[model samples]
Target: MLRRLLVSLVVFLVVGAIGSYGLMRNALATPICYFDSVDEVSVIGQTGHIHIGTLDNVNAWVGTYLIDLDFETAYDVYDGRYEGYCIEDIYSPDNEGGYALYDAEGSSANYEAAAYLFNQYASSVSSNAERAGLQLAIWEAVFDYGSYNLTQGNGNFYVYNGYLSSAITYANTYLNSLNLFNPDTFNASGYGLVSDDNPLSLDPQCYQDYIIANPIPEPSTMILLSSLAIGLFGVFGIRKRLLRG
Candidate 1:
């Protein structure tokens, strides 16, 4: 009887450990950021900076390589701080930044600029598919840097790490979907100063968007279910052994 109890306990511990580990692994695989209402303003503000900065950086990187445009010129086009031909002027409100070029349209000037740049770069490449691929790669790098900066930067409160984590999660999903960063083929030579160490999965973003779109089992819930399963299996196994004996 003692031996049987020991066996059951051992089984329970082993099963619990396995279940906990599996839950942890799953949690790590699909990181979810949890936040309270207080974090909304900060998160939104930081995300905005990330978005604008990324656009400016991508324009700079691509324009420098393809058209030999200087960094200051590229910066002025996207950054609202400067006057004339600024993309922010078209999309955001007057109080938000620069003067509006036109009445608010379907797409913002930021996106318009991005599309224009993509087309310009695409025309330079001989292969249509390669051109699309290169554009995607540049976009991916831009977002990757944005997400990385948001998560790692000192913009948000350290206690509210979830805000940054959420940002990174969203960014990762968007960038990963593009499928442009294959280790074998992607060459970052002319793509500005994109760090080799910066990978997509590490950064997280868009938690609110992601959570609404994808509702997955919580880690606690998963562990609870796993424990219940282990208990049931142990009970059944013990009953079978008793019957056999």
Candidate 2:
């Protein structure tokens, strides 16, 4: 009976180990590939709104903009404004909304508000357990965003368009260098070909963008490996006992 149990345990462990190795290998083998094309464009002439998404999907969150608002000083704006609130954006929050700077003549107040808002919500839903409420929080946050607005001659908006453009260009170049294939395109709802003037929810433009695989490891494989390792170890111990006897 003991011998049979030991043998069974070893067999199970070997099988599980093999399976885990295979899965990890597969993930590594099929690297996500993006097009290896580099389009060098100066950030000087480019002017448009960029957006970021809540979920790792196609739709971008509203109210967020790719402006260089001094977040360090005004970072507390979003925290204080949305403190103790679980609600989300049902509309575009203009708080993070700021116009693109062409000749450097716009208010940074809205941009600052927008940046602070983006950091607030983006950091909030960092975990999978909390991500479910992200959509609601975002919508609620948008209405919260619009509460702040930019008016004429309030301050210099001075959108760092050149910095934004450089970031995008650098991202494209890096992806091209990776030689990765089958890359998924990131498109934000607030500013893109699919943008709606009065979008239902606010999605902001991305300050920077790139693709990354889901961080969480596979649960199934983890369990299997644990079970297999324990079983094999138990089996080896029994075999040693038998030999000693």
Candidate 3:
């Protein structure tokens, strides 16, 4: 009878451990929270697409509705000072098209906020940063294209497809120039730096998830999970023997 009880406990524990592990895996697969606006701004979405935009404080806001990267609410990368923020134009041909580089003017004390963002980007040895830098280069390229358009006084709007194609190539050149990423190995899957070299094709969420998920798991959670799994297995073994008896 004692052996039977032990078996039953063990079986129960094994099932529980399996269940818990499954749960953890599922949770890890899905994001806890996507992007959201911090300010009381109305998000306007593009027809037949996931893109979103808001007019309020649009100049300073940095986020995307489709591949949500709300700098205001999520990371507060622009709380005090302004280095730069990722932005998309609602009126542009593609929501993913167009980007900017902004720096706050004024005293040094108020600019650390921007510094924080730069540091975050500059310090990271991650592939995402390499891709992000590519996107930044693309943005610069597009901006230059627009400036040319303006200089020529062409009232027609600029499309992004050609620029996007060229931007990827341009970015690769820049990446090669810096020798931060491999020219031949760069792909756009957001897997690692060189694996995804196409900067324009990068999904913002993919980049964000890479940043959020790849961080080392907390020691406390690891300990808890290990303990739980061990306890569960022990109980399961006990339960199996109990049932046999």
Candidate 4:
């Protein structure tokens, strides 16, 4: 009877560990989302295509949406569809900061601001104009140095609109509405940075970010799951000794 109890407990632990590990794997995995479609007439594509990447605050996000590779010059990646399994993060640790995000010493800060921008004002985007505006707002936060302004550089960091345009104007509206809203205070847990090196983006002024309704578990949850296996082992040892006695 004792041996049978022990076997059942061991089996339960094994099953639980396997299930937990599978869940953790799915949670920690890099997210996969579809570009779906875009309202812009970019040469990239009207569907399953978008452009985004950044280098720093000093350099403009030329044809960038969320993932630029360097600061020496904005490398354009305007060729892949990135529909199902064509996107990848070419982040190199020793590429001399081959990416502007890290070169400018503001990678984390940029993402925080970008994430905030997405969370704060990405829901009402129903048109190309709104999308452009949101993208511009995200860029302002991402390329932000010590201050936040989209029109303050010799031409490197300056972007403007001629009339009552929706893109640029809407972006300013986003910046203005969130005056005291600190990006640091924002909680960006469910979202992640999606990047691709194929089919570089075309126009930087019309870049944008979109949403997908898929959420994954956090890193902490993964830790909790991993710890379960060790804990179960300990419990099993204690039970085995007790049963013997």
Best candidate according to TM-score = 4
What is candidate 4's lDDT per residue for 104-144, written digit by digit as tens? 11125555555556666765565656665666666556545
What's each prediction's TM-score? 0.23, 0.28, 0.23, 0.44
Global lDDT of each candidate: 0.30, 0.29, 0.30, 0.41
lDDT of 2: 0.29
TM-score: model 4 vs. ground truth: 0.44
Cα lDDT, model 4, residue 193: 44
lDDT of 2 at 239: 77
lDDT of 2 by residue, 90-166 (tens): 22323333211110001122222322323334444333323322222232223333331112111111112322333
| lDDT, residue 30, candidate 3 | 30
Q: After superposition, how far is residue 160 of candidate 3 from its true place, in Å?
A: 12
lDDT of candidate 1 over 1-245, digit per residue (tens): 74677577667766776776555534322223211111111111122222332222121111112111111221122211211112211122112211112111112222222333332343444432333233333333433332322333432211123333433444344344433423333321111111111111213221111001112333445566666677668867977888898
Clashes per candidate, residues 3 or more apart or on different chains: 9, 37, 30, 19
Q: Please state the error at residue 199 of candidate 1 in Å.
A: 4.5
Report clash pairs, candidate 1: 166-205, 167-204, 167-205, 168-203, 168-204, 168-205, 169-204, 169-205, 170-205
Winner on lDDT (3 vs 4): 4
The per-residue C-alpha lDDT of model 3 at residue 157 equals: 19
Alpha carbon lDDT of residue 10, candidate 1? 66
